[model samples]
Target: MYCVQCEQSNKGGCAVKVGSCGKTAPVADMQDVLLRIMQGVSAYASLAAQKGARDAEVDAFTPHAWFTTLTNVNFDADRFTALIAQALDMRAKAKACAVAAGADLSDLPEPATWNPGTTASELAAAAPFAAIQRFMDRDGPSIVGLRNLVLYGLKGTAAYAEHARVLGHEEAAVSAEFHRIAAFLATDPTDVSALLAQSLAIGALNLKVMELLDAANTTRFGHPEVTMVRMTPVQGKAILVSGHDMGDLEVILRQTAGLGINVYTHGELLPANAYPGLKRYSHLVGNYGGAWQDQQRDFDAFPGAIIMTSNCLINPEIKSYADRLFTTGPVGWGGIPHLTGHDFRPAIARALELEGFTQDAPEQRIPAGFARNTVMGVADTLLDLIGKGEVKNLFLIGGCDGARPGRNYFHDLALATPKDSLVLTLGCGKFRFNREDMGDIQGIPRVLDMGQCNDAFSAIQVAVAVAGALGCGVNDLPLHYAISWFEQKATAVLLTMLHLGIKKIHLGPTLPQFLTPEVLGVLVDEFDIRPTGDVADDLARMLKAA
Candidate 1:
């Protein structure tokens, strides 16, 4: 019943009783078991791959198992327990294949029980365990915090990788690496250099995973284009699609075609409007709400069935509309129906079954017509403005948004950026400034809305392209990063930036609780990473540096 993989831990530094994200003890225990099974699968797959087995088939299930355990993704203990069993079965099948091929496979351990409802402490008290409890019992905060950070980042990467797979883009190497890391976590590896290398490797591989997803999305949906989306409700029985999976949204849009149900984007799905293929649906309406943190209130008022496609799912409070909430693709909440296996028939059925609004109501609309392809398509005009000295700089100001009050800093920073500078944003953090009227410079929109957090890949691509066009290094370009992080995907993006040598970025809404002073100091000294301060002062410093 101890969990240390998320921001909200209990008083004992783990979710010993109930998870902060509303996961019960049985669910947490099942997730841990699932992770262990994923490692076994990974270990077997790695051995198979080394023994000249087909790389694609060796251990492809590892990432899917790992992703199922991410925070806010799965709360169903029964489903998780079944998944652990499935992974164990997969491992056994792979091991048998290796043995049948005359490969030496004597070192593998017998498959452990995948049963749920047991704590690590209880398992430690029992016999014949691998002493996983001993590592969990370590008392030092520094060691435990570092372990949690690494595990959490892996969990986030697993989720993103799974979404990529759903779109038929499989990077076998990334899944293989994920399984390798999961196995490494199971062992008591004390090599600091090896652990550090693994941490950076996770970041580096996440870059490839995200690139695969980007290709999957853009190739399927066409590169995102600039198009204004109305926030107003359309006349019909409508369903709202939230979170970041455009693949799921596309499926639902296709399924609900001619069914008389209007589909609206919500949260990270708001960026779907920027994709030409997705935007072509006449019944596909505008974005419905703000960021994930604001969902309780937003969902409460909306008069339609809601489909959550990914993370940031909070526990449902109202029993009346509880049946109306549907989740899929690594997003789960207790008591909510989850659609599985690339089929959203359940969600579509629920949307139709529930009496959704039949008429359009007067609703608000905001202009969110910016994504990488759309913005880059206008790069020629932007270059013209820059060459004319009308545009001064570009500030990439976005990340995860939380309920914390200090998040106002991001809104203020976006507002405070010089009039001559453009504010580029992605993820829910853009909600703070997406609605603001930051007038364009020539033909370039000042507040450029890139896609979701994963779409940070797009931001990096834009930066590198701008650097090339300007005949300068990315760091030498008039670009500054003022990022606000609230979760692990942000962690991966920050690491990717560091891997690219992007420096002097301002980060805030509080640094990760897992970062020790020594580690924080290393980042500050090496990367010039700093916490956000007064908007005016931070702006002055960035502008002065430019």
Candidate 2:
């Protein structure tokens, strides 16, 4: 199996037995087959779309199915087997739609026509020849690397699009782009310029997805506002909701509203405390734990039920908390109870049966809810401070947090910023030093928590507003970025930054293993993307540049 779509790929690339994220060779192979089948479905779907015959179910399924192939989302081979069959059936329906519309289908690729059997074993056997890497033989490393960039970016975009879809938000153009890219990859073209254009196009598509999600979240929950969330546990039966799904979290909060169970946010859900509609619940206590990578230790020590709503679910730690663990939406495992149709009663019952916090822990608090609206609310204040030179440098430091070493660089860099500068953080990466006492510059807090990684939209809004107020391009503003990434969502966000002409981003922990030197050189030369260096050195360089 060969998978380098994530930062944690084993020994640079998972080219041998299994993936570093605990994905078995069989599961990885099955995932590859599923992706190939998805391309076939897309092949027909795109043709059907061209002929003005569109299927909403087929359009929605494209992102939902693609989302399951993302890193650490699904590990169950049986699940992939079922999805493969579904894709095959969908392909037939799409083909019928295209033929009825009088679209020609004679010149399709193997993925658009071949059926690799029904069983898991059959799919695994076909994986080697069917995988995207098969194009490396004809396309070479640089082109293959660029193709993978587009592929991973699409996976990230699909994940966000699925989240938006769950909330009754859908754009026909976004769905069309998914089918467009899927059909593009099916052909395995070797033109480097075309592939690069596709990469940036994915970035542009992702911006739309993020905007849709931002609207979905804000419209449903109201814009996030400043709120102090209790970091310590309170005495009660508890349920912790993790991952990036606010809709699932809201459903859980509703069903458990009058049941005397306390619903707590964990991981990316930490920002839920700041949303007006969600925080209005009296029993939705506070955030627990730090990041997804620390869940093994955190969940084991927790005294209540847990439900993972989205990505970053690992396999090795399930046995430690499997009896109390549940999954919903696209997140799945072989044994975990999968909640469907937003019925979370089983999870709530489990939480009721388990003992929660026996007594209130010592009180501690951290702030959240500084999304786009909140930041812009204080824009005049921010700009006035910048003009007065009270705030000289603005540092945006955050992304996905992983268990791998060297992440302490972000922790150290966040602490090393000048007191006059403000630190803007989002995603799980903020757990590194979010609790630190950075005080405030004038009346503005030094560290601003800008919702989840899903809230990168908010960060982008803040950047653009600040730059426009200063009468300069975003790249010319006195702002610096230190981005830490672990998965494809971060890949999509990085591409969005590049797409906006934001330059000189310091990205690290490690560069993506899928990026060959030639491709990395292009990013470095074109966008001035830098691999992070020593904390002091990078900090000094950023300050010097400012």
Candidate 3:
């Protein structure tokens, strides 16, 4: 097995017995096999869609299949086996539709026509044919790395598209583009320039997905308002909802209503408190945890049932709370109780039986809801401060956080920013220093917490708005990007930044292992991207440039 899809990959790639994310060789290899089947499924699906033979179920499953393969989402090898079979079935249905539509399939690649015997051992044997390391051995590092770059971006795009689809928002064009790219991968294109262009195209595709998610969230929940969320726990039977799916959380809130259970937000769901539709629930209490990386300790301490709505799941082998841990949506572990169709009665029953917080803790709260609309509502104030030179710099520092080393740099960097500058943060990375008091710039809070990682769209909108008001391009503004990447979503966001021609951005704590030096050089040459250095040095440098 070989996997370098996350920042915490073992050494350069997980080519041994287990991945750093706890994915075993069997599970990892099977995931590759599932993706291989999906490529064939997509090859036919894309052509079928072009011939007006689209299948809605196949279209939806395409994104769902890709999203399941993302880091920390699913680890059950049996789950991947089921998905592989499902992909083959979908492939047959799509191929028949294309054939009926008079589309040609003679020139299709192996992914579109290969027949692996239907058995676990047979699928395991086929895994080697799909292994990415084999691609690296066949085609050199540069070409393979660029293709993986595009593949990872597609994974991120699929995640966002799944979120949007659950909210009743989707576009056929988006799904068609995803299949087109997957079919392209089936051919094993090796042209570096063409591969690089496709990588950027994936960036543009992810931007559309992010936009769809933003619209879905805002439309369903109303624009996030500036509100203070309690950090202290309230005494009651409780269920903690982690991950980034508000649609799932809303369902839980409805199901558990009047059941004397307190629903707390964890990780990226911390921002849900500011949404009017969600916050209107009196039983919906406070945020209890920091980020996804800290979930083991957090879940162990919380005296309630836990529901993971999406990715960022880790193994529960060492935890006693695994019994009470529930999986929903695309998140799953080998033995955890997987909930479906928004029915969370089992989790609710467990929460009622368990002992929740015994007493009301000391009241503490933090501000959230500074999404694009909220920020733009106060744009005149921000613009006036910028014109007067009171706001010296705008530091956009946030992305996925991990337990890996060198992450302390983000915490230190946020604290080191000048008092005159505005620090904008989103994603789980803010959990590092978000609790610290950064005070305020005039009437504006010095630290602004935008929504989740998908809300990187909100950040981009804010930057472009600021730049337009200043009569300059986004790069011409005094905005310094110090992004921290942990998984493919971060990869997709980075590509979006490059696609926008945003330059001189800093990324860390370590670069992706998949990128060869030559490909990295190409990105650096074109975008002026740099690795994160000393916090004090980066602070001084960004402030000086401002």
Q: Rank the candidates by lDDT, best first.
A: 3, 2, 1
Each model's C-alpha lDDT?
0.74, 0.88, 0.89
How far residue 490's Cα lies from its native spot in candidate 3, in Å, is 0.6
Between which residue pairs do clashes occur in model 1? Answer: 225-274
Give the per-residue lDDT of model 1 (tens digit) for 130-192: 322445455355555555556767877776787788788986566667766765765545555
- Collision count for each candidate, in order: 1, 0, 0
Residue 371, candidate 1: Cα error in Å is 2.9
Lowest summed lDDT across 10 adjacent residues in model 1 is found at: 123-132
Poorest 10 consecutive residues by lDDT, candidate 3: 8-17
lDDT of 3 at 101: 81
Pick out the ten consecutive residues of candidate 2 with the lowest summed lDDT: 11-20
lDDT of 2 by residue, 47-102 (tens): 88887777888888888898998988998878888998998888888888888888
lDDT of 3 by residue, 418-439 (tens): 8999999989999998899999
Give the Cα error of residue 356 in candidate 3, in Å.
0.7
For candidate 2, the TM-score is 0.98
